[model samples]
Target: MKKPLVLIVDDEPDICELLEITLNRMDIQTYTAENIRTAKALLQQKHFELCLTDMKLPDGNGLDLIDTIQASPNPIPVAVITAHGNMDTAILAMKKGAFDFISKPVDLAVLRQLINSALKLSDPVVTKERRIRHELLGESLSMWEIRSKIDKVARSQAPVLISGESGSGKELVARLIHQQSSRSDHSFVAINCGAIPLELMESEFFGHKRGSFTGAVTEKKGLFQAAEGGTLFLDEVADLPLPLQVKLLRAIQEKKIRPIGEHQEIPVDIRLLSATHRNLAEMVQTGSFRQDLFYRINVIDLHIPPLRDRKADIPALTEHILVKLSAVNKIRPPALSKTALAALQQYHFPGNVRELENILERALALYDGKIIEYDDLNLPISTHNKLNCPEYAPDFGSLEDYLEKIERKAIILALKENKRDKAAAAKQLGLSVRSFSYRLKKLNLDS
Candidate 1:
C-alpha cells in the first residue's frame, strides 16, 4: 500500500522540518512549502492526502486556501494552524471549508489524530466503493427480492424510506435509488443526520452566507443546494432534531431553502431519499419525530431484510464476498466447504449482512488459500448450539401442524431477512407456487 502524503505550509523552517520528521516516523510522506503560492503550485502538480497551513502567510491568508481547495478537481483536506488568541480565525477557517483547525504549538498526538481522521474523510469514495464491492453476493430468494425491489424503486422519483438494522444495506439501497433515478446525471449527496453536531446542523443542511456568524467568513452551500438537480439522501433521518425536522419538512414541501443570514430562498430541483434504522412510527407516537415530516418523506418505503432470515442466500453471499475480497487483495480465492457453508447458514446474524461480511473477511485472513473448513470458520458456540437444541423445540400433534409452524417461521424470517421478498421465500422453502400461496393464506402472514 502507498503511504498517505501530507503537505505542510508554513514560513517557519523549524516547524516544517519538525512536522516532516514527526510524520515520516509514522510512515507518512510529507511535502513542505513556505507560502501560499508554493503550496498551490505543489497542490496542482501532485495530490496530497492532507494539507496543514498556518493562518498567517507572507502573500495571503490561509483561509483563502480553503476556497481554492474546494474549487480544485481533487480537494485535499486543509487544517488551519492558528495562535492561541486567534481561535476566531480558526473557526472562520472551519466555516470556509477547512476540515479542522489547530492552535499554535500543536501537540503531536492531537495533530496526528486530526490528520488521520481528515485523510479518511477526504477519500470517502474509496470506502464507499469498498463497501459496494462487498455487497450483492447472495443468490438466495431474499437476495433476488431485494435486487428486484431496488430495480422497482430506482425507477421512481417517489421519496423512499429504508428501514433495517444497522449494516443491512440501507445506504446501499439509497445509492441504488439515486443511481437509477432521472437525476442520476447529477450529484448524489448523502448526509448522516445523527452525526452532525447540533450547533453545526443548520449550517450543514441550509448553509451560511459570509458574516452569518462568528466563524462564517464566506458563503457556503449546504448539502441540499449541493445536491441540486440530483438526489439528497438523508441517512438516519429519525435522528434529526424536532426543530430542524420542521425546517427540513418545509424544504421538502416547498422545494426551497433560505441560507442562514440570507433573506431569499434558493429554489432546488432535486429528488429526496431518506433512510433510518430507527422505527419512525414509534418515534412519531412518542412525540420525538414530527408526524408531518414522516408522512412527507415516507411516500414510499423500503425495508432491508437481515441476513439470518435469508439463510438460503448464504452460499451465494459467501462466494461473492470471497471473490471480491480476493480480487481486492490480489490473492487466489479460497473455497468454502459444505460444512462451512452450513455453519454460516445456521448462524443468527444480529448485525445482518454487514456482520456476515466481517466474518467472511476474518475467515479470509486466516484461510491461507485453502478450502474454508468448518473448523476454519470460527463461529460463536451459541449459534451452533441453537441449531442442535431439541429440548426447547416445537411439538406438533401432526405432520401438517409441524410443517405449518416451520413454513410460518420461514416466511416471517424471509420477509425480515430479504427485507420482505414473497417470491424468494417461496422459492427457498422448495414449495410449489400454489402451495406457498396456500401456506401464506393459512398462516395470515401474506403482506
Candidate 2:
C-alpha cells in the first residue's frame, strides 16, 4: 500500500525538516519544496494527500501558488503557515481555498489536528459522498463562497453564529458543519431556543435528576448531555431569555453544566453552533441579550445569503426539492416548464428555501401531471410586482397595470438621478444589476 504523501513548501530548511520529521512519525511520507517553482514541479510529478506551504515563498507567495494549483486539473488541499500574529493573512488564505492554517512557532498538536482534517478530504469517495450528503444545493457565487467558508469553519472547535432570515436553512448549515467535522459520528442535537418555555429552559439544556421538579418523573439527559462529544446547535438562539443566557454562557465558557437541582457540575465535550434570524448585536445593544454570551458564541460568523440574492440558483434548488418531494411521495419527480422556472426566478422568495419547498409540495399535490407548469406554482406575483409601488398613482388600474406604471416611472427617475449609471441606479433601488436590467427590458425602458 502506498503511504499518504504530503508536499511541504517552505524556504526555511529547519522548518521543512521539522515538518517532515513530524509527519513521518505518523507513518506519512513527505516531499519537500523550497519554493513555488519546486512545489509546482513536485505537484505535477506526483499526487500528494495534502500540501503545507509558508505564506512567503522565495519565488512567489502562497496565495499565488494556491490560485495556480486551483486552476490545475487535480487540485490538492493546501494549508498555510503564517506568522503567529498574522491571522489576517491566514484568513485570506482560507478564503482563497487553503484547507486550513497554522501559526508559526507551530504547536505540533495543532499541526497534527490540521493534518488529520485535511487527510479526510484526500479520499475521493469520502469527500464526494460527504459533499452530496450535506449539499447546500446551489451554484451561485454567494453559495460557492459560503461553502468555502463552511469547509474552513468545520475543522475548528470554535463557536459559529449563523445569521439568516427564517426558513433560510440555517439549521442545515449547522448540520453540514457537524457532518464534515471530526465529530461526524457523534450526535448532532439541535433545539429551538425560542420554542422552549423559560421555565423548562434550564432542565432542557442541562439534565435533571429524577424528581428534581414536578415534571421530572425520571432521570433524563439534556441537550448538552445528549450532544456529548458532538455538536449542540442552538437555532433561533437570539430568543433565549436573558436570565437563561447567563447559564448558557457559563456552560459554554466552562464546558461544564450543573443539572437542575444537582449539586455537582458534569463536564461536557461539544462544539457549539448557533443561528438566529434576528440581529443579535442589536439585541445586545437593547439589553435583550447578554453581550458576554453573544461574544462567546459568535467566535466565527457565517451569514447565509437569502434566496432572492442568489436567484441564479433557483433552477437547481427547484430540481433538488422536487426530487426529495418525489421520493417522499413515492412518485416520479416532476419537471418544471421553462415558463414555470422563469416565474420562480422572477419572483422574490421572502421565505427563502423553505418557501420554495412549500411551493413545490403544493404544486406536486395539486398538479396531477408529471410536468409542473407556470400556473401550477400558484405563486403570488402581485406582491413582488408591487414591492416598489408608489404611495399614490394618478390613474387607477389593475394591479399588473399599476405595477407596470410604477416600475417604469421609478426606473426613469432612478436613471435620471444617477445620470443613467445603471449600476448606481440599481444600487440605489436595492436591486441586483441583473434584476434591474431585466426590469428595464420588461417595462420597455431600454430606449
Best prediction by lDDT: 2
Stretches > 4 Å off in candidate 2: 1-134, 368-370, 387-447
- Give a tens-digit lDDT track for model 2, residues 76-166: 7788999876756765676666766777887686678668767876666666655644478898998888888788677656678999998
Cα lDDT tens digits, model 1, 213-328, are 99998899999989987789999999899889999987875556999999998876566889998999999999999988887677667777777777777777777788888899
Model 2 pairs whose backbones collide: none
* RMSD (Cα, Å) of model 2: 12.1
Instruction: Please provide TM-scores, in order, for all candidate models, with all chains considered together.
Output: 0.56, 0.61
lDDT of each: 0.75, 0.83
Find the candidate with the highest TM-score and give its number: 2
Q: Tell me the deviation in Å of residue 333 in model 1.
A: 1.3
